[model samples]
Target: MKKYIKPYYYYYYYYYFYMAEKIGIRTATIVIKDNRLLLVNSKYSDGDYYLFPGGGLESNETIEEGAIRETLEETGVEIKIEKLIHINEFIYSNDWNKRSLTIFFLAKPISIRKNNLTDDGGKIKQVEWVDISKLDEIDIRPRILADILMKAKGDFDTISLNHSVDYKHES
Candidate 1:
């Protein structure tokens, strides 16, 4: 005799496996000068929240290549990645359900030009150099991103920044 499985059970099983198999990779840069960090205010869904200039890695792209592409795309500044800063992981259960692996790197700006940046959806936004001392006042993503910056100032090798991707979401 064959056993019958419920449709909802199959649906939940597929959902779990789908979430587990889906993986996202991103690259971000730390561009600092004097005592300020270069950040961009995204005008998209997370408007007002400050974040480093970088984005998801395209298919068949190296982490470094994605970093360069994203930095140049987000900010009008060309950058040269210097060293690996930290690897961050975040999970969200909102519209897009999955986890993301963000690779942060320390980089220097090679050149800057007059231009503007927009999200993949064409949301024009402003970019600014934020003083590290005032980091506490701004609403930033991956909250721990700030802590990582502070730790980097010292001699910390690796930091386990635990945070939810959709911490800003009201679910």
Candidate 2:
């Protein structure tokens, strides 16, 4: 049963949606524990992809606050964000135009509140603790995340950030 929505509400909804499409800011956390990293596995019609535990920054929250909040929401674990790893701007579009500057952070989980993955409204299917060495076997996005993690304990302090990767086409 479809409920009735007023004309003004529809205008508000579309306006908000348009603004969200214009500027999308996201965050990703690198949580390493017991020689393993936490990851979320997502299955879609095109293929499967793994995401680090993180999400969009809220309107009134700082990047660190959003990182901690999103981590808990997606993984059911409380986290303490330690340091920023990198800030990269990714420009890509599918149906709707989407350009997001993703802030990657190094964080530690304070406690595991739940053993299973929490509801991401069906976006994520499962959560797993993957061994650091086995990241080669899975499909992780940004393509540089795993490498960035591997260098964390070494000279991560010297890594250059704000590198832009353009996936936009020549259309």
Candidate 3:
């Protein structure tokens, strides 16, 4: 007679959740402090909007690595990842289907150099540090990116993603 082995039923559920968590939308944001926060003005289908100096994470790269690489590539500034401030989930279905899970981190600028890299085959129009005090003057992506920075207190803090949406139709 052969020995019989039974598998635990909970294992399947656990694995499913783990995989979902791993692949559940991913993005990164880097905050480089000068007198202001480092922001990138990039072309969007709907005119232009501002965002931090980070983007989607490439395969095999950790979030920190991605943040550093993206920031360097976008702004030509090497940055040290300080702490994660917030994790946001963005969902929008309009002109195009889009969904993202973003990781926002507080970073310190290590060096400043000119960036020759460009996105979408065009030169990056502008890379500038805006005063943190003037955050309201710019159109920031996810909006909460700025809010968390203003609210961060001590080191290594985490916050749930909270964003309010208003309906606006663009032609």
Candidate 4:
């Protein structure tokens, strides 16, 4: 007789999530210092897109811990995690099979370190403190910069968006 094992128990959590095309939870921080939002300006094929400082949650890491880690890794800044503001589901029309849940939190910068990319995101073209009034000029991902700027604190919001984000799946 052969021993039987369950695939779910053997496979990695994220890998299983990816294979199933389920909700991938990511964390991001809205670091507002001196009334300016911290944004990473990256040049993509579509155009320059600005995004908050964060990334997908890692295995065995708490959301708060992952949020802080991602902020530092992407923006070279340490942030003090605050309240959660929004939970967004990004559905790419180009690739409907993949989806991600972005948890946006309102946080403050505690320290500034060297900007490093631990998750292989292309070199950040520029990390700018974008003025709230000037947000309309640039294209931002998730398409919720306006709402985020308006409701900076208290209460949570959810947005289901179909947009273009270069989320490449490994073969």
Better of 3 and 4 by lDDT: 4
Tens-digit lDDT track of model 3 for 29-132: 55645557788876665667777777777889898898888888888888888777777755444413344566777788888877545453443467888877
Model 2 misplaced stretches (Cα beyond 4 Å)? 1-21, 93-98, 115-118, 151-155, 159-171
**Model 4 weakest 10-residue run by lDDT:** 162-171
TM for candidate 4 is 0.73
The model with the greater lDDT, 1 or 4, is 1
Q: Relative to the unseen true structure, what is the Cα RMSD of model 1?
A: 4.9
Measured with C-alpha atoms, the lDDT of residue 91 in candidate 1 is: 71
Count of backbone clashes for each model?
0, 0, 0, 0
Off by over 4 Å in 3: 1-24, 94-98, 116-118, 151-158, 163-171
Model 4 deviation from native, Cα RMSD in Å = 5.3
Q: Write the per-residue lDDT of candidate 2 for residues 1-171, one digit (tens) a residue.
A: 245567768879888877556656888787878888888887766567888888888789998999888888888778888888777666665535666777888888899987644576687887789888888788876557677666554345653465444644210
- Error (Å) of candidate 1 at residue 61 is 1.1
Give the alpha-carbon lDDT of every model: 0.74, 0.74, 0.65, 0.71
Location of the lowest summed lDDT over 10 successive residues in candidate 3: 162-171
Best by TM-score: 1
Order of models, best TM-score first: 1, 2, 4, 3
Winner by TM-score between candidate 3 and candidate 2: 2
Residue-by-residue lDDT tens digits, candidate 1, 1-171: 124567767878988887545667888888887778888776656565778888888899999999988888888878888878777777766646667788888888888863744455654367888887788888765567786676567344664555465654411
Clashing pairs in 2: none
Candidates arranged by lDDT, highest first:
2, 1, 4, 3
| TM-score for candidate 1 | 0.75
Question: Worst lDDT window (10 residues) for model 1?
Answer: 162-171
On lDDT, the stronger of 2 and 3 is 2
